[model samples]
Target: MLKGSAILEKATGKDGTQSNHSAGKLLMIIECLADKSEPVRLMDISKELKMNSSTVLRFLTALVDNGYAKQEPETARYSLTYKICTLGSKVSSHIGIKDVARPYMTELSMLFGEVVCLAVEQDREVIYIDIVQSSTKMLRSMQRIGHIAPLHCTAIGKLLLLNYTDEQLDHVIADKGLTKFTESTITTKEQLVEELQSIRWNGYAYDDEKCEIGARCIAFPLYDVEGKVIAGVSVTGPTARMSIKQIQLKLQPALQIIGRLRKELGYTG
Candidate 1:
């Protein structure tokens, strides 16, 4: 037991008691699906969460009943339903961060001649919320809106890390140790801290051939109304065409545009 955890247990006065929140249970079931390593089985949920099989079935039945999920009759396996996407779309529309970032991301790709991506912190990683392609004719990937990436290798990843304190950054490092992809990838904890510190001061990041060999990326912190850095936007391109300095000099103006869009959305900063 850590010092603060023992203090918290004494204060809360019921350390052994577990929370019985239904919403928490539902989310735990969803997370259990992710751990199955294959299409989910009810047994996986029960075993992983240590909940009763009957209880897991009942919860899953309720989700299936509501169209939030579905079970395969042939296999007795369950998966998220199409309705989840509809519900997700409805939720994303009102998330405020995604709504505020769309136009700036669009304009950045148009101005930079590269692919622009907007991502938000999900757990200790980044989930792509929006992507704007530079041109249809250029070598471009169809951006999947919900794809996730490591928060230590990509430009947007490091940009988000800029907001963390020394201790929170330590937690991130412990949760997801730095993984290397290319020769330039920062694989150590201290190096990431130094990089984030510079990003905090310079207000932008340059990922030089880190995630992919030929790819170079640059990103900046996106502030909400109160100047809180909640998310980030990045522009990616081939390293052959976009040099390190060019990423900073040519596309650095995207920061100003993103700042204006945030302001329009009532972001005071």
Candidate 2:
């Protein structure tokens, strides 16, 4: 377990001659603020980082000035802002899940001659981060990387919601009302609750021309090392080629590939 001071020293340089000492100290203060769930006092941060109160205040002032942190007017305590999470999300979108899942997406696309997508939940919607287009020349899915879809309509979106509690689900419905896109689209809480139950029992989700009239999809949950649903992978195609029967026939092979992917991701269940 490397301590924060050790990391700070390494980041600044072991030799005490580094010019980036201020940058390192700023980062240390940021980490100190992040480690706490509630707003932290100025003196507590100074004591924990072994720095003078004035020095910590200077760095904290800079952070607050830049919108990376906020100070409570009543409590006079500091805490990190959503800006930190914004920076982290930008970095993770570029190098994390998309990179690890692209090869598997390609495999699925090649195996099925259909579009494959990788998606994660953000702000109550599913965002497609990576896509492997099918080799088929006739028709291509309109979905593109970075496109967002509602959580109640698409197969991948429903799959990603497997872990949401009833209260959370209700909140989502209240925030983003289920807008119907097609005749089969679920438009009420009761319908969505029943659909989610079936998804849980079947270990997968299906979109039967729900999102778009001719488009259909089948999706499975992608798990992290802790057995949490981190994302979802789905195959989409035209209704002519991806009827319910066809989706059922392809289910086992898709599950096999996903099983291998889960193992690689260190998911035990």
Candidate 3:
């Protein structure tokens, strides 16, 4: 039985029996092990956390079972697994990409008086991670954050598609089957491949009412620290307000913003 302590007291319930103290104690154990230079023994964890040895063992067992911690069979010492490092890297990458791109998205929206969207490719589709509506009261778009759209129709989608190899693009089109949303939507693999080449040459892509009738979008790819296309940024609006000529004239500012964003993300090329 553990002696009286604030943690144990807080872990105990009104019924006077030991409650689920495992959660807090588990965290404490992890923190204790993290601060140490080497794998820690069970007794050391229990002593440092001021919890019962049995309770520490129970939590440690759960950690090991869940792949968050590992134990040396001969030494009976425990340490955190590489899974934590993997999770941390993923979280950092996601946050870093989004953080570097958000200001650029907002700047584009304000500069163009059109909706701006940030999206990343996942499983051959473009998933919207963020959206900033135009400042203009009557001209705002209704696209929601976290919405998903096909990668063959939208400007952002095509911008990302430019990164794909010929074989990879063929595979995606074969699997996803470039279903048309409008008359302008690329309905064949050949047409999409040709458009992708043009996008690479022009350094940007235009939706031009391809995804939805009367909607126009101009998008450019964003590179990561590794010079790989990690996401796309787009300025989107109704065609009546954002015609092809207007979008062409406004391309310089968008390019400058994307250049700044790429540099912030550590893209050298």
Q: lDDT of each prediction vs. the true structure?
A: 0.73, 0.82, 0.79
Model 2 Cα displacement at 213 (Å)? 0.6
Ten-residue region with minimum lDDT total, candidate 1: 1-10
The whole-model C-alpha lDDT of candidate 1 against the native structure comes to 0.73
lDDT accuracy of residue 175 in candidate 3? 87
Model 2 spans with C-alpha error above 4 angstroms: 1-94
Relative to the true structure, candidate 3 reaches a TM of 0.67
- C-alpha RMSD by candidate, in order: 13.6, 9.0, 8.0
Of the two candidates 1 and 2, the one with more favorable lDDT, higher being better, is 2
Top model by TM-score, which number? 2
Candidate 1, 2-47: lDDT as tens digits: 2323322332333443323554666788667645555688887788
> Model 1, 47: alpha-carbon shift in Å?
32
Report how far off residue 39 is in candidate 1 (Å).
40
TM agreement with the true structure for every prediction: 0.63, 0.72, 0.67
lDDT of 3 by residue, 35-113 (tens): 8888999998888888889878776776676677899999999999887686687567766878778888889988889
Candidate 1 lands at a TM-score of 0.63
Ranking of predictions according to lDDT: 2, 3, 1
- Runs in model 3 deviating more than 4 A are 1-91, 138-142
